[model samples]
Target: MSNEAYAQQCNVRELMREDANSEVFFQKYTLSEETAARLESIREMLKDDIAQANPLWKVIAGENEEEVYSESETSNNDDESNHNESQMMHDQLVVPSTQFYFTQTERTFVETSDTSAALPQRCDILESACESLERNNGRLDFVQLENLSNEDLIPVVDEMAGKLSLKGIYNLCASMNNMTIEQKIKYLNVLCTHLLLPKIIELEEPSRLLSSAIVECVKNFPDEIQQFIFVPLLNAELKDTMLITTIINSFDLEKKAILLEEFLAYVKELKSWHISILQNFLSVRLDHNMTDKITKLFSGKALYYSKDKTFGKLILSFLKLNTALSQEQKNLMVEVVAVNETLFKRPMENILKNM
Candidate 1:
C-alpha cells in the first residue's frame, strides 16, 4: 500500500511538474472527486515539462503538412478517429522528458536555459517516438518510408540499442546479417548507446553490407566512442571479426586520422589490451593480401612498433601482400600521408575528386 502511494506521488509530481491547472491532472492521479479537487488547487505549483503530450498533440500535429489539425477540431473529432492512442502512451514515451536522458547537448541546453533545446529535440525525440510507435504497431507506415531516406539515422540505431529487449536485439542482429549497408544505417538510428557495442560485434563478416555500414557510421563518432566502442570492438574481434574487407571498404583517406586515432589508442592501452587487439589486427593484416594500404596508412609509425615480435610478420605481410585493392586514390592516400599522421580532412576531398 505504501509503495502504491509512493508511485502515485511520483506520477503526480511528474504531471504537476508540467502544468497544474489542466484537465489532464485527473487522468494522471486517480482519487475521489474530493481529493482530486484538493489536488487541483496545487496544480499551478508545477511546471510545464510535466505536462502530458496529448494536450499538445494537436498543436504539434498542426505542423503536419497533410492537413491542418487545429486544437478544437482535434478534440471535437477525437471520438471519431479509431486510432486515438491510449493514455498509457506516456509510459512508452521516451523523449521530450529530459529527466530520462543526459546527452552532452541536452545537458548544455538544459543548464543554459537555451531555446536551442529544440534543435537536438527533433532528431533525438523523433527516433525514440518512432520506435515506440513501431513496437505498438502504431500507424508508422509513413515513418518507415520517411526513415528510408534519412541516411544518417544514427539515433535509430542508438535507440534500438537502448529500447529493445536483449532478446529483440539478438533477433535483429541475426536477421541483419543479410541486410545491405543502407538498411543497417536506417535501422541504426533506432538503436540505443549501450547496445551499440554488441551490435558492432555482430558485424563479423567484414565484407557484408552490414559490416561495411557499421564501419562507415562509427568513423565519425566522438573521441570517447573511438575509445570505447570502436577500439574495444576492434580489440575484441580484430582477428575473428573479418575486418579486412570492411577496413578496405572504408578506404576513404579523409577518415584516416579518425581511423588512426582509434588504432593508435588501441596500441596505447594497458599492455594486456594491446596484447589482445594487436594480435587480432596483425592476424587480419597478414592473412589478407593488403600490404600497400597498410604500409601507407601506417607510414613511418611501423618502424617504431616493428621491434615487437608480432610486428615482423605484419611488416613482412606488407612487403608480400598483394596490391590488387590499391587503386589510384588509395595509392595517393599512401603517398601523401605521414606514416602515422591521422587522415582527418583530405580523405573527403580525395573521395570527392575520385567521384
Candidate 2:
C-alpha cells in the first residue's frame, strides 16, 4: 500500500482500539514521524470535506477560503481566473433572496343602524306599558318599578310614588323638558307626593337632588302652567314648603301673591310649623282683603285643634310685624290674640305693642 493509505488505515485501527478499550484500560502508543505527518494531512482533508457538506460551515469556510486565496494571490503570481473562481465559490454559498406573494381581498362596507331611530316612540311605549300593567291589574311596586324601563314608567310616573328609586326619578326629570303640559303636571304631582312633601315635613335639609329638578320644570313653564299645574299641586294636601320659597324667590310679585293665596287657602289643615315658616315668607303686602282669610287660620276651631297655641301666637305676631298690614287688619290680629289668649297662656303685651 502507499504510505498515505497505510497511515489512514493505522489511524482508523487506533481509534477503534481506543473506543473499544476506553472503559477497560487506556493504552498509549506513539506513531512514526512519517505516519504522524500523513495522518495529520488526511485529517485536514476530512475536516474540509465535512465542513463543505454543511450549509452554515460552507458559508464560514467560503469566507476563510476567499481570505486565504486573496493572501496567496498577493504573495504569488496567481492568475485572475483563480481569484474569479474563489469569488464564484463565495457566491454559491450565499443564501438566495426569497420573494413573498400576497393577495388583498376587496373591502366590505357594512351598513350601521341608528339605534335611537329604531327605538319605540313615547306613545308606543306607553301603550305597551299600559298593557303590561293591566296584566298585573294596574299595580306597580318596587320590584315592578325596577324591572320597568324609564320610558315605560314616565307616563304613569305618578303611580311610581314611594317605589321609584332616586336615580329613576332623576332620569324621568331629564325627560321632563320634552313632556307635554299634562305630562309634566302629572310628573310634578308624583314628585310632590312621594319625594318633596315627605322630605319637607320630615324637616330634612332640602335636597337640591329633589328640589332642583322640580324648580327646573316649573321655571320653564308659562303662568298658565304654573297656576294650573304647580299652584294646585302646592295647594294639595301634601305641602312641599321649600318649593314655596323657590316660587316666591323665582316668580314676579303678582304671581307670588296669586300662588301664596292658593297655599293660604290650605293653611287651616297644614302643620303649624309650615304655617309659621310660610307666614314670614309673604313677599306681597298684606291688605284687608287677605285679613278674613288670614284670621280664619286662628279661628276657634283652629285654636281648639291646636296642640301648640304658641305657634298660633307666633303666627299672629308675624302678622302684627307685617308692615304691610293696614290699621284695621292689625286690630283684627289683636282680637285673634285675645280670643286665643286663654289657650296661648302668654302675655299679649308684645302682640299689643307690635300692633
Candidate 3:
C-alpha cells in the first residue's frame, strides 16, 4: 500500500475506536436504526480490506484472521454488556427510599418567663405531658393539651420531633381553629423552628410529609403568616424544595409569583434534580412575566453547566414547556444547545421548529 493509503487506514481505525470509546459518542450521540444498520454493512464490506492493510495484524494474529475476528467480536460484546449493566446499576442506585429518616439530638431547654415557684410547676406539667405523649404513641390529647397556654405548649412541641409522626401533627393542627390567627402563627412557628426544620433531612420522604402537613394546616390561614413563615423556609440550609414547590401549587398565581421570586435567588445553588422538579411544578402555572424571569435565570447559568446531562435535560424540559418565551430567551437556549449538540440536538431542533 502507498503511504497515503496506510495513513488513511490508520485514520479510519482511530475514528472507529473513538466511536466505541468516546463518552459523548457512547452516551449523547445515538445512531438512528437505519444509520446503525448502514454502518454495520459498511464495516462488513471493509473487513477484508482492513485486515489486509493493517500493520498490527501480523504481530497480533499472524495468518489466523478468524481467531482475531472472534476476539474482537467478544470484546465488542463485553463492552455492550458492561454498558447495559452499568446503566441498570445506575437506575437501581438512584431510586430513593420512601422511608422517613432523621438524626436526633437531646432536647434543649427553652426559657419561660414564669416566676421561680411557678417554674417547677410548669416543669412537672411539661414532663408529665411529654410522658403522656410518649405512652400514647405521639397521639395528642387535645382536651389535655388545649388547657396548656401557648408558652407551655412550645416545649412540648419541641419534644414531639421523633415522638409525633406527621399524621399526629396534622391532626393536632387541623383542630386548632379556636386559636386566634396570631396564636396559631405563634404555635406554627414553634412547629417549624422546633419540630420541622430541626429534623429536616435531604431525603424526600421526611420533607414530603412535613411539607404536606404544613400546607394542609396553614392553607386556610391569613396570607400574612404564610408570607412570614413560608418565605424564610425556602432558605433553610437543607432547603426543602418539596415544601416550596407544594406551597407554590397551593397558592394563588400572585402568591406563586412571590414564592418564585424568592426561589429565583436560591435556584442558583439548587441541585439538578431539584431543578427538574421545579421545572415540572412551574410549568403548570407560571405567569408570563415570572416565566420569562426564570428562563433568563436558567439561561444565564445554562452554559456554565452545559455539559451536565441532568442540567441539559432541565434545559430541554424548559424549552419544551408551553409557556411563552421572548426572542432573547429563545436565543439563549439556542446558544446552549449549540454548545452541547450531542445531548441537545433533537430536542433543540423540535423546539426551534415549534417556535
Estimate the TM-score of every prediction: 0.27, 0.43, 0.50
TM-score of candidate 2 to 2 decimals:
0.43
What RMSD does model 3 have? 38.8
Q: Judged by lDDT, which candidate is best? A: 3
lDDT of each: 0.45, 0.53, 0.60
lDDT tens digits by residue: candidate 3, 1-355: 9999999999999998888887766786678999989876765655556654553453343446676667667777998999999999887766543111111111212223333345445555555544554442343444455556767776766666665555554554454434566556556556555665555433355455456655765566636335555555555554445655565677776666665666765555544545645654554466666666666666666666667777777767766764367777677666767776347667776886689
Indicate the worst ten consecutive residues by lDDT in candidate 2. 98-107
Instruction: Give lDDT for model 1.
Output: 0.45
- In model 3, which range of ten residues has the least summed lDDT? 98-107
Backbone clash pairs for candidate 3 read: none
Clashing pairs in 2: none
The digit string of per-residue lDDT tens for model 2 on 1-355 reads 8999999999999998888778544445667899999876765655575654543443443446665555555645555778889899877665332111111111111112354545555455444433443442232222333344655554445444344444444444445446556655545445444543444444335556545655665667645435544455553443345655655566677776776676676555545445544554555666666655665555534445344654666654565556455666566656666546444435544655754
Provide C-alpha RMSD values for all models, in order: 36.0, 19.9, 38.8
How many clashes in each structure?
Answer: 34, 0, 0
Better of 2 and 3 by lDDT: 3
**Sorted by TM-score, highest first, which candidate order results?**
3, 2, 1
Cα shift from native, residue 205, model 3 (Å): 3.0
